[model samples]
Target chain A: MEMDSGERFIVPPVNVRETADQIIVEAEMPGIDKNRLEIMLKEKDLFILGRRAKEEPSMGDPVWQEIPHYDFRRVFALGDHVNRSSIHASFDNGVLTLRIAKAEEAKPKKIEVAFA
Target chain B: MQLIRRNRNTTPDLGGLERLQRELSDFFDWTTSAYPTPFRTFGLLEGAWSPALDLYEDKDSLRVVVELPGLKKDEFEATVHGDTLVIQGERKSESEQKKENFYRVERIYGQFHRAVTLPTPVDASKVKASYKDGVLEVILPKKEETKPKQIPVTIQSE
Candidate 1:
C-alpha cells in the first residue's frame, strides 16, 4: 500500500569510506524489513533499493508529522578500482553496509629501497 | 479516513505532468555527482543533530515516533517533565577503525535533544516506550479526568 502520492524516492543519507583493502558504504534506512532490501550490481553500477513496510493505522489523528514513508533508492557508479565480483552487502539494525574489495592494481604497493 | 498530505512547498501542485518532467530530469542525471550539493539535514544550531519525529493523538493516548537509526537501546534516554516530553541521545560512529580516506561523509553524528510539549495532560506514570528497527515510539495515555465524558440526554414530562 502506498502512503504518499507522487513518484518520489527518498534518497537515504549514505557514508562512503575507503580502507586499505576495501571500500565501505553505509546507508541509513529505518522502518525497513530485511526481506524488502534489494542490492543489485550491473556492469559498473551498484543499486540499492529498500521498500518500507506499510504503517498500520493504529494511532488516530496526526498532530505534527515530518517522517516520510517513501521507498529508498540509490545508485552508485563504481570505478574500475573496485572488484565487482567480491562485493558484499549486509543489512543490520536498519543500516545497510556494502563492502567492495579493492582491485589488485588499486591496492598500495610497497617499494623497497636498495642499499647502494 | 483519507490521509491528507501536507505539502511544505508554497508552490501549487502541477499534477502528473510536472512529476513526469521531474522524473525525466532525474533519469538523465543518474549519478550523484550531478547533484551540486549532497542532501544535508542539519539541526538549527551548530554541532548538533535532531532526528525527525511524528506525533499522533487518539482518544485514549498520544503516540510519538522518532527515527533514530544506528543506535542501541542503551544509548538514549527519555523523560517526562510536567507536560513536556524530552528525548536525548547520542549517535556515535559505527566503526572503530581509523577513518582516513572518506569519499563521501553525509551522515550526521553527535548529541541530540528534542522536547515536545503535549497538548493535553497525560498520565506520566503509565507512559510506555519501545524501540525497534532504529525507531523509538513513546505512548502516553491521557489522564482519566481529562477524557471526554458523554452525558445521557434525558427527556422529562411533568
Candidate 2:
C-alpha cells in the first residue's frame, strides 16, 4: 500500500462468526493496551479506538528517531438484525472481542405440527 | 586567526548552546526524511505511546514487561539496533471460507513496529526476551557506566 499522511498506521483485522443467538467479532490488536481501548455502538455502526503510551528512556544519552505513538481507530457497519443495545466488548492481550446478539424477532423459531 | 573567525561565524547571537540545539534539531529532521508519514505523526508524542512499563529492577538486572495479546511468538522479532530496541511483528488474519457471511468486522492487522530506547545502556550481548500468556518481557542488564556504585562512609568522633 502507498504510504499516505492521512492514513492511520494501525488498522485492526477482524473476524466475524455467528451462532444461533449472537455474532462474535474477534479483532487482532497486538501491542495495544486494554485501558486505552474504547468501544461504542451508534445506530448500526461499531467504533473501536485504542491508544498506546510512549516510553521514555531512563539512562543513556538521548537519541532521536520516529516511532509510532498514537491512538488506533476503526469503525464497522453492522446489519439490521444486530441488537446494538445488548452488544458487549472485552479486550485481553491486545485483542478486542465483541459479542453482538441478534434481535429476538430475527432468530429462527420452530413450530409444532398437528396431524389433521 | 582562522580558528577565531570560524568560531565567530558558527556561534549565534543567542548563545553557543542555543545555536547547537537548533543545528541538532535541523540535523535530526533532515536525517529522518526517509521516515514514513505515519511514523512522523506518531513521533509527535515520542515515548508516550506505550503506557508506563512495569519495571522490576534488582541488584543484578532489570526486567521490563509489556502486554501484547493475540500475537504469536514467531510472528514477532525483537532486535537491538544501535541505541534503539526494535520490536517488529505481523498479526495475520485467519483464513475465511468464500461462502461465509460477515455481518460485522472490527480488528487490526498488518505490520507493527515498536522501538524502545533503553533508559540505561543495556548489555545487548546478553539480553533476553520472552512472551507468555499475552505478555512480552525484556531483560536488560545495566552497562558498566550506568551501574550503581557503593560509597563507604567512615564514622569519626570529633
Which one is best on DockQ?
1
Write down the C-alpha DockQ for each prediction. 0.53, 0.16
Query: B1-158, model 1: which lDDT tens digit per residue?
Result: 21221112211233556645654554555443422223442321233466788899999998998888778887898899888888887777544446557776657666778888888899999999988777889999999988888989898988
- CA shift at B78, candidate 1, in angstroms? 1.1
State each model's C-alpha RMSD to the native: 8.7, 16.1
> For model 1, what is the alpha-carbon lDDT of residue A57?
53
Across A1-116, the per-residue lDDT of candidate 1 in tens digits comes to 12234567777888899988999998988778878998987766687889876765566799989788788877788999989999888887778899999999999988999999
Q: Each model's TM-score?
A: 0.79, 0.46
Note the B-chain TM-score for every model: 0.69, 0.54
> Candidate 2, which segments miss by more than 4 Å at Cα?
A1-9, A54-67, A111-116, B1-68, B71-137, B142-158
> For every candidate, how close is chain A to the native chain A in TM-score?
0.85, 0.74
What is each predicted model's overall lDDT from 0 to 1?
0.75, 0.58
Estimate the overall C-alpha local distance difference test score of candidate 1.
0.75
Instruction: Flag regions of model 1 displaced more than 4 Å.
Output: A1-6, A55-57, A112-116, B1-38, B41-47, B93-97
* lDDT (10s digit) by residue, model 2, range B33-152: 432111112222231223223445655566666555677768878787655566666656443333445643323334556666555677889889987535677777778777888979
How high is the DockQ of candidate 2? Answer: 0.16
